[model samples]
Target: MGCLENLNYEILAKNCSFKETRDIVKRMCKERYEIPPGFKIVGKGVVGIPPIHVGIREEKLVCTYTKPCHGTFVILVDSPEDIEQVRKNGKPVK
Candidate 1:
Protein backbone atom coordinates (compact mmCIF):
# COMPACT_ATOMS: atom_id res chain seq x y z
CA MET A 1 0.00 0.00 0.00
CA GLY A 2 1.10 3.56 -0.57
CA CYS A 3 2.19 5.71 2.32
CA LEU A 4 -0.98 7.78 2.19
CA GLU A 5 -3.28 4.77 2.33
CA ASN A 6 -5.75 4.76 5.23
CA LEU A 7 -4.68 8.23 6.29
CA ASN A 8 -6.86 10.46 8.45
CA TYR A 9 -7.69 14.11 7.88
CA GLU A 10 -9.53 16.77 9.88
CA ILE A 11 -11.64 19.62 8.53
CA LEU A 12 -12.18 22.95 10.25
CA ALA A 13 -14.79 25.38 9.05
CA LYS A 14 -17.60 27.71 10.11
CA ASN A 15 -21.05 28.45 8.65
CA CYS A 16 -20.85 26.09 5.69
CA SER A 17 -23.09 23.49 4.12
CA PHE A 18 -21.89 19.87 4.18
CA LYS A 19 -23.18 19.17 0.72
CA GLU A 20 -21.50 22.27 -0.64
CA THR A 21 -18.20 21.32 0.96
CA ARG A 22 -18.38 17.80 -0.43
CA ASP A 23 -19.19 19.08 -3.89
CA ILE A 24 -16.29 21.53 -3.80
CA VAL A 25 -13.80 18.83 -2.83
CA LYS A 26 -15.15 16.51 -5.49
CA ARG A 27 -14.70 19.19 -8.13
CA MET A 28 -11.19 20.00 -6.99
CA CYS A 29 -10.02 16.37 -7.11
CA LYS A 30 -11.60 15.87 -10.49
CA GLU A 31 -9.92 18.97 -11.89
CA ARG A 32 -6.54 18.62 -10.29
CA TYR A 33 -5.87 14.89 -9.81
CA GLU A 34 -8.36 13.39 -12.25
CA ILE A 35 -9.68 11.28 -9.40
CA PRO A 36 -12.70 9.29 -10.43
CA PRO A 37 -15.73 8.56 -8.24
CA GLY A 38 -14.12 10.85 -5.65
CA PHE A 39 -13.67 10.36 -1.92
CA LYS A 40 -16.31 8.87 0.34
CA ILE A 41 -17.65 10.85 3.31
CA VAL A 42 -18.30 8.81 6.44
CA GLY A 43 -19.42 9.44 10.02
CA LYS A 44 -22.38 11.26 11.61
CA GLY A 45 -23.01 14.82 12.73
CA VAL A 46 -20.67 16.08 15.45
CA VAL A 47 -22.17 17.80 18.44
CA GLY A 48 -21.15 21.38 19.15
CA ILE A 49 -19.48 23.55 16.54
CA PRO A 50 -19.96 22.39 12.96
CA PRO A 51 -20.42 18.71 12.22
CA ILE A 52 -17.36 17.00 10.75
CA HIS A 53 -17.34 13.84 8.69
CA VAL A 54 -14.40 11.61 7.81
CA GLY A 55 -13.63 9.15 5.00
CA ILE A 56 -10.92 7.87 2.68
CA ARG A 57 -10.46 7.43 -1.04
CA GLU A 58 -7.47 6.48 -3.16
CA GLU A 59 -5.34 6.77 -0.08
CA LYS A 60 -6.32 10.37 0.48
CA LEU A 61 -7.94 11.36 3.76
CA VAL A 62 -10.99 13.62 3.47
CA CYS A 63 -13.06 15.57 5.98
CA THR A 64 -16.35 17.26 5.11
CA TYR A 65 -18.75 19.69 6.72
CA THR A 66 -22.06 18.33 7.98
CA LYS A 67 -23.30 21.38 9.89
CA PRO A 68 -23.35 25.11 9.21
CA CYS A 69 -21.06 27.60 10.89
CA HIS A 70 -19.88 31.16 10.43
CA GLY A 71 -17.14 31.96 7.94
CA THR A 72 -15.88 29.52 5.31
CA PHE A 73 -13.00 27.09 5.73
CA VAL A 74 -11.57 24.10 3.83
CA ILE A 75 -8.52 21.89 3.89
CA LEU A 76 -7.06 18.73 2.27
CA VAL A 77 -4.31 16.36 3.27
CA ASP A 78 -2.96 13.28 1.54
CA SER A 79 -1.63 11.62 4.68
CA PRO A 80 -0.23 12.19 8.14
CA GLU A 81 3.02 12.96 6.38
CA ASP A 82 1.32 15.70 4.44
CA ILE A 83 -0.23 17.05 7.63
CA GLU A 84 3.22 17.66 9.01
CA GLN A 85 4.23 19.31 5.79
CA VAL A 86 1.21 21.59 5.98
CA ARG A 87 2.06 22.46 9.58
CA LYS A 88 5.72 23.00 8.76
CA ASN A 89 4.74 25.24 5.87
CA GLY A 90 2.82 27.36 8.39
CA LYS A 91 -0.44 27.02 6.53
CA PRO A 92 -3.45 27.53 8.79
CA VAL A 93 -5.84 24.55 8.85
CA LYS A 94 -8.70 26.79 9.91
Candidate 2:
Protein backbone atom coordinates (compact mmCIF):
# COMPACT_ATOMS: atom_id res chain seq x y z
CA MET A 1 0.00 0.00 0.00
CA GLY A 2 1.05 3.59 -0.56
CA CYS A 3 2.03 5.93 2.26
CA LEU A 4 -1.04 8.06 1.80
CA GLU A 5 -3.26 5.02 1.88
CA ASN A 6 -2.07 4.26 5.38
CA LEU A 7 -1.86 7.83 6.57
CA ASN A 8 -4.61 8.94 8.89
CA TYR A 9 -6.13 12.34 8.27
CA GLU A 10 -6.61 13.27 11.93
CA ILE A 11 -3.12 12.19 12.83
CA LEU A 12 -1.73 13.90 9.75
CA ALA A 13 -3.44 17.08 10.80
CA LYS A 14 -2.09 16.91 14.31
CA ASN A 15 1.44 15.64 13.76
CA CYS A 16 2.82 15.61 10.22
CA SER A 17 5.64 17.92 9.19
CA PHE A 18 5.18 20.66 6.66
CA LYS A 19 7.39 18.94 4.09
CA GLU A 20 5.34 15.77 4.31
CA THR A 21 2.06 17.61 3.99
CA ARG A 22 3.34 19.68 1.13
CA ASP A 23 4.38 16.64 -0.80
CA ILE A 24 0.96 15.07 -0.39
CA VAL A 25 -0.78 18.26 -1.45
CA LYS A 26 1.38 18.68 -4.51
CA ARG A 27 0.71 15.19 -5.74
CA MET A 28 -3.03 15.24 -5.15
CA CYS A 29 -4.22 18.82 -5.29
CA LYS A 30 -4.81 20.14 -8.81
CA GLU A 31 -6.86 23.17 -7.83
CA ARG A 32 -7.03 25.87 -5.18
CA TYR A 33 -9.55 27.82 -3.16
CA GLU A 34 -10.01 31.34 -1.90
CA ILE A 35 -8.76 32.10 1.57
CA PRO A 36 -11.46 34.06 3.20
CA PRO A 37 -10.72 37.25 5.12
CA GLY A 38 -9.11 36.85 8.54
CA PHE A 39 -7.90 33.31 7.92
CA LYS A 40 -4.34 32.57 8.86
CA ILE A 41 -2.52 30.47 6.28
CA VAL A 42 -0.99 27.41 7.93
CA GLY A 43 0.43 25.53 4.93
CA LYS A 44 0.72 26.16 1.22
CA GLY A 45 1.42 23.19 -1.02
CA VAL A 46 2.30 24.96 -4.25
CA VAL A 47 2.98 28.44 -5.48
CA GLY A 48 0.87 31.02 -7.29
CA ILE A 49 -2.53 29.73 -6.31
CA PRO A 50 -5.27 29.47 -3.68
CA PRO A 51 -4.68 25.83 -2.74
CA ILE A 52 -3.29 25.14 0.76
CA HIS A 53 -3.18 22.29 3.25
CA VAL A 54 -4.04 23.99 6.50
CA GLY A 55 -5.42 27.25 7.82
CA ILE A 56 -7.22 28.85 10.75
CA ARG A 57 -10.49 30.55 10.12
CA GLU A 58 -12.84 31.49 12.96
CA GLU A 59 -11.09 29.11 15.30
CA LYS A 60 -11.51 26.12 13.00
CA LEU A 61 -9.12 23.92 11.07
CA VAL A 62 -9.29 24.27 7.32
CA CYS A 63 -7.70 21.49 5.33
CA THR A 64 -7.32 20.62 1.66
CA TYR A 65 -7.36 17.19 0.08
CA THR A 66 -7.82 15.51 -3.28
CA LYS A 67 -9.61 12.44 -4.57
CA PRO A 68 -8.44 10.37 -7.49
CA CYS A 69 -10.17 11.57 -10.67
CA HIS A 70 -12.48 13.73 -8.57
CA GLY A 71 -10.47 16.96 -8.19
CA THR A 72 -8.92 18.85 -5.29
CA PHE A 73 -10.99 19.87 -2.32
CA VAL A 74 -11.07 22.06 0.79
CA ILE A 75 -12.75 21.49 4.13
CA LEU A 76 -13.07 22.89 7.62
CA VAL A 77 -12.34 20.30 10.24
CA ASP A 78 -13.30 20.73 13.86
CA SER A 79 -10.31 21.52 16.03
CA PRO A 80 -9.21 23.50 18.98
CA GLU A 81 -7.84 26.99 18.47
CA ASP A 82 -4.35 25.96 19.49
CA ILE A 83 -3.04 23.22 17.23
CA GLU A 84 0.44 24.60 17.68
CA GLN A 85 2.08 22.20 15.28
CA VAL A 86 0.11 23.31 12.25
CA ARG A 87 0.03 26.95 13.32
CA LYS A 88 3.73 27.18 13.94
CA ASN A 89 4.89 25.34 10.85
CA GLY A 90 2.79 27.02 8.23
CA LYS A 91 4.40 29.29 5.65
CA PRO A 92 2.61 32.58 5.92
CA VAL A 93 2.04 34.91 2.99
CA LYS A 94 4.49 37.72 2.47
Give the number of the best model, judged by TM-score: 2
lDDT of 1 by residue, 33-94 (tens): 21112222222222223223333345564444333435434445456543233234322222
Q: Candidates' TM-scores?
A: 0.30, 0.39
List per-prediction Cα lDDT, in the order shown.
Answer: 0.38, 0.42
Candidate 2 stretches with Cα past 4 Å from truth are: 1-53
Residues 4-94 of candidate 2 have per-residue lDDT tens digits of: 2333334223233435554554444333233332344233232223434455555555564444453444444454532354556555532
User: For model 1, what is the error of residue 89's alpha carbon versus the real structure, in angstroms, after optimal superposition?
Assistant: 30
Candidate with best lDDT: 2
State the TM-score for model 1.
0.30
Candidate 2, residue 77: Cα displacement in angstroms equals 0.6
